[model samples]
Target: MFRDWFKKDEKNNSRDIPDGLWIKCPQCSQIIYSKDWNENYKVCIKCGYHDQLTAWERIDLLIDYGTFKEIYKNVAPVDILGFTDTKPYTQRLKEAQEATGLKDSILAGQGEVNGIPIYIMVMDFRFIGGSMGSVVGEKVVRVVERAIVDKFPVVSVIASGGARMQEGLFSLYQMAKTSAAIGRLSKAKIPYINILTHPSTAGVLASFGSLGDVIIAEPGALIGFTGPRVIEQTIKQKLPEGFQKSEFLLEHGMIDMVVERKKLKSVLYSILNHLWRKVW
Candidate 1:
């Protein structure tokens, strides 16, 4: 009877636990309940690490309900180079699309922030590291152009690893294209606010991402033109502690402020309220 009891106890103890119920914070290594983490905008309660959000999640967090009308929805990437590494570029694109439900890395649209109309573009890091490719560039240019025509402010949330390597020169060309479009927006005197997230680096940072009228980054985000390891190797010196983080950038005047995720919407609304007169 004791053997049977032990067997029953073991069976009860071995009952299945659902996956993804808890998440370990990358910054603090604290295991957090998934529900609580999500409720707090995926920010770690202990360490305050701002976790990456999906493009749709960002839209829901920032935009008023039912106010986002996505433009350039049909603009998808094409494998013009037939590039192949471990896998074909087309296959990689297909997988990314399937996995993220995004046609490309970016989602460009018109949205309302506290009833204030604006044009917004949000990049999803899940799609090939949010790499800027031909489609991404085209969509950016088109969105800015639309904002110019509509006489509205433009807000860009940048989260990219860099230019997409698969597109080769085509990807690099987008830096110029996006930067030139932003120049036109500036010429029109429209307010262009850039929100840089973690891993905003390389070509994207060198171009339009850096050309914002007001640049804001989240706390602890990595924002720089090059990775610290490569830079240290090239310079033959150790880099500063917290180098390339948003707070570091702010101290050096590279960014305007480091805002928390929960307060971003109100902050953006305040910016729009202050800048709305320029649009009129």
Candidate 2:
């Protein structure tokens, strides 16, 4: 019966299996149908593990259909330091751009979430581990500034390793820059909802990522200023089990909630509706 259904469905009629027809969950190694995976918002139905989302995918998942208007599209990165390890930084940037179809690791824009207007920023981990460079910082700052001006509630979805190393001090400086931006929004009494996805860490976590008025993290997401391995080495002691994971963070009072991907949109809407109305 399943074979018959696959044959009759026009979308799967081709002799060659469609791209992304099956995805294996990294956590549980369950073979999942692509449609089912998307229907569940890229979460594993078997192990309940949430997969990472690209910047565009995150936007689509959260934003109301046909409502997103992107900001700062022209703000591309510049190679200021002429840095090179094995290859030049510019070459790396080109390759990342081609692969992700984005000028940078982060995307910022305005969109509606369940009829509530919002300004949103999302990071693509595929792009240099979603590094915060000069462009990324500037874009985030601009997005927050726009939110303050328009009085739109803000949402920043973070999935990053840290600040870009190629840009050197330029990247590190973004921490202060973005932090200042978020601070301004705080002064304006704007609600900033931060959703930390898998592996939000390093300078990104130390800065604006942790400054959200309401911080929500996905289940099992790694949230910390440093990697567990580094911490273990530095402290010369074995770390606690599940250290830096979202649930652990919540237990330690580091974050407000550990929301599942399926419930994230509704949870965000509920928070916005409840808090925003009180402020407005």
Candidate 3:
């Protein structure tokens, strides 16, 4: 009986040690309590570095509790090109789907932000680097169309390495398709806000990503067509400091505002409320 009691005490003592109690911040390399990091919106308290959020996490952050209703959840990507490199495209798609619990990189839904009804589409970088393929393009166009029909405002959060190269020309075609959809939104005079996150680039940046009525970017986000390394290699010249970053883009008139992660919701709420008097 004493032996059994000692074993039970040992088990209880072992359980007392917390699992994943501390996390290392990628930016500052600061050891922070996991709970504290999460409570601060995943920003490093020491260096103020904002970590990327997954599509669902971002949706929860911006959308009111129990208000987000996802639209076009059934839309899945197609293997039109049957392309393969080191691995089969089908295998890649399946793996990404299972890992992210997402059918594609982009998620479109309607939600209330601070009690204001709005339509939002958010792209996640974890899925194939958040590349926009035919399905992503189609979903974005649909979001704009729904906004037009409902006369509601639209917001698109872009975080992509650009068009999905696996789809070849089919992926390139999405640039034009989404651009045309945004054109319609413009004609309708519906407010379309684009929120550019880390590394918005390539065909996505050239298309609907930049066609926003107001373009806003997160602090330290990279926004440009071609990457700085590629540009430097092609030009055989060194690039300026902080090139294509959100602050640099703001100075160059490429984007409207650069907002910190914590203030994003309030800024968005203010903008949406300003656009629609009934949003309050």
Candidate 4:
């Protein structure tokens, strides 16, 4: 009891100090200072915890300094059946825009990684779970087409909850559109690297998420068509521990490797470097 009292006293006294800042490390559960962590790009020094990054942050971290150029291709919305629930579809679009600060879910552009020019696309989950709708499909197809035309490789970082539910059958067509574009890229022998982020599911998984020439996943990310709970309810059986996790997918031959966040740039650089050595 005396020891517990002393510990509590120490904790209270420590809080009195002003040279303290709190940041959570996802790997080792350490509380660090903001200055220290921001200097280290939010990676935990103790256990290399990779903090969740926004899509824009990922592009910033991946690309060479001052080498990203945005490619804007405005795609009009296709409103079939006048889909609406609870509020008008336009109102939902407005809310999503205000919340995510994005005109759309996917961002595509040209960026240089270590002086090597490449095409890149990333899905912003904050925009309706990064659901692949008509605009997303158009964006992806345009990027892939541009990549093929320019003889550049495409690296797609995806975190999607599958096809957009609001668009119905129109959403499903994107799967075919993207798959066809990827096929064209393959026929041209251009490499496509799919970096699967958290919660990649359903139509997204069925398409480009799994079609990379080299597929990589973050540690412990959940990547599968159906989530564990949904499968459990449908199968009426409990899943084995850690099923459908990145490691499980690696073991099951779905992913090539599980790359840590800090090392992600290095690993991708090596692959692109090796491939470009032969081409450029």
Candidate 5:
């Protein structure tokens, strides 16, 4: 009986498990069960490295259950420039849309956080690197305008690679447009908080991403205008370790705080509560 039981255990150990049941942590290289990783908000258990989240996942993480009402769902990107690279801009948009199930890279809406009403915008890096185009800029402007009218605070979670190059000048123009809208929000004295995520860079970083009254970044997030490699090549000097990371930026006085992914909702709620109380 003992011999039979040992053989059965060996057979079970040799059985093939389906793919995606395990995840490899990029930072620590430790294999983790997918269930545990998801339960931890996709953060690495061994090293605490934060993985990128889809816009909907982020919304579910931050917004109170059943309280998120998406706006501007109909606003889709247009190939105004008739732009084409290796592939046509339209085709790329279609593929990204099909893959991510989003009209654009951004998801903007009104949601309640811990029973506090707020307007929130989240960018999904999966969609064309979360590049900002005309629709994204328009949605951002509209969301902030709505917040101004509703007298509610605004929160933006930025995960971007910068302006959409296919749109050419139209993409770059969003920087100005979004900055001006945030200016209006600032003038209104309403609280605007920005949560910078991994790969928050380029045009997005230069504009409204940096205009938040309180800017927060996730641990280990890449936050910068230009990438470190490009800067090093241009300057012909090696960059410092951890350059432009969330922790580095915080140490350099660039951002307000570096919060863990698991604590983001609570931190946001606490900050919003304090800031909202001052507004009233």
Candidate 6:
């Protein structure tokens, strides 16, 4: 039994270990192999770390038939202040368009999961890290209004850093405006499903990110006003483990549920099924 264990199996340790395809797990900060990360919804194998997902990928997985009617597609931003910072804001917008093949940060549409109709708003983090500006806020309000008019539930997938700084205080106003719109939707008695994705922070969180009837967050997503490091510095103390995380927030009684990416659709379907039973 002891003889075979000590034998040289291969020259594995003789040479340098080559760099494997790596992607940062948004949860654990572990750079893991791309193939494994992708296979596990970008979750880290070592620590069950969940990574951030793009709007396109998220919508494709959550919606049935991959057939959602897009709304508010042409609501482009207007440069009222002639804003510039080495590159013009409009030019930056063009660059983002070319990079993401999306008109703007937000994607609004009507889609169904298992024939249960719902209006969705997915924010693409690729487009300026999904910052919520006036236009993004306006588009979200339009979708909320549409959901109200259609008498359907609203499901918003949020992944944003904060208010769009390029627009200055104008972007900050979206927080209040969007919150008011959600308040109106709430008054309509239509359910709002807020699926908070990774890296959600700042102004967006201050408003609708926490306003869902049943709030759900992807595991390992960062949800907070100020980041952990910033908070630690301000408080002059080291933060606790897993601060601002979905699980941490859940423990502190902030969120309703912490769901994985793969199970999101089924969970949503189940919730909706139970809700719509009394209606129809």
Instruction: Compose the digit string of candidate 6's lDDT tens values, residues 1-280.
Output: 7997888867754766566667776546777778877777766787876666777777787888866888878888866767898889889889998998888888888899888999889999999889988888898799888878888888989899999888988999899999999999988888888888888899998998789888899888899998999998899999889999989998998889999877899999987787667444
Query: Which is superior by lDDT, 5 or 6?
Result: 5
Error of model 1, residue 25, in angstroms: 0.7
Error of 5 at 240 (Å): 1.2
Cα RMSDs of all predictions? 1.4, 5.4, 4.3, 4.7, 2.7, 5.4
Please give, for residues 1-280, the per-residue lDDT of candidate 1 as tens digits.
Answer: 7687656566557868799999999988999999999999999999999999999999999999999999999999999999999999999999999999999999989999999999999999999999999998999899989998999999999999999999999999999999999999999999999999998999999988889988989999999998999999999999999999999999999999899999999999998999997557
Best by lDDT: 5
The TM-score values for the models, in the order shown, are 0.97, 0.93, 0.92, 0.85, 0.95, 0.86
In the range 42-94, model 5's lDDT, one tens digit per residue, is: 99989999999999999999999999999999999999989899999999999
lDDT of 2 at 250: 100
Quick one: ranking by TM-score, best first? 1, 5, 2, 3, 6, 4
Worst-scoring 10-residue span by lDDT in model 4: 11-20
Which scores greater on TM-score, model 2 or model 3?
A: 2
In candidate 1, where is summed lDDT lowest over 10 consecutive residues? 4-13
Better of 3 and 5 by TM-score: 5
Which has the better lDDT: candidate 1, or candidate 6?
A: 1
Instruction: Please give the lDDT score at residue 51 for candidate 2.
Output: 92
* lDDT of the candidates, in the order given: 0.94, 0.93, 0.91, 0.84, 0.96, 0.85
Model 6: per-residue Cα lDDT at residue 122: 91
Q: Compose the digit string of candidate 2's lDDT tens values, residues 196-265.
A: 9999999999999999989999999999999999999999999999999999999999999999998889
The superposed Cα distance between candidate 4 and the true structure at residue 197, in angstroms, equals 1.0
The count of residue-pair clashes in candidate 4 stands at 0
Q: List the candidates ranked by lDDT, beginning with the highest.
A: 5, 1, 2, 3, 6, 4
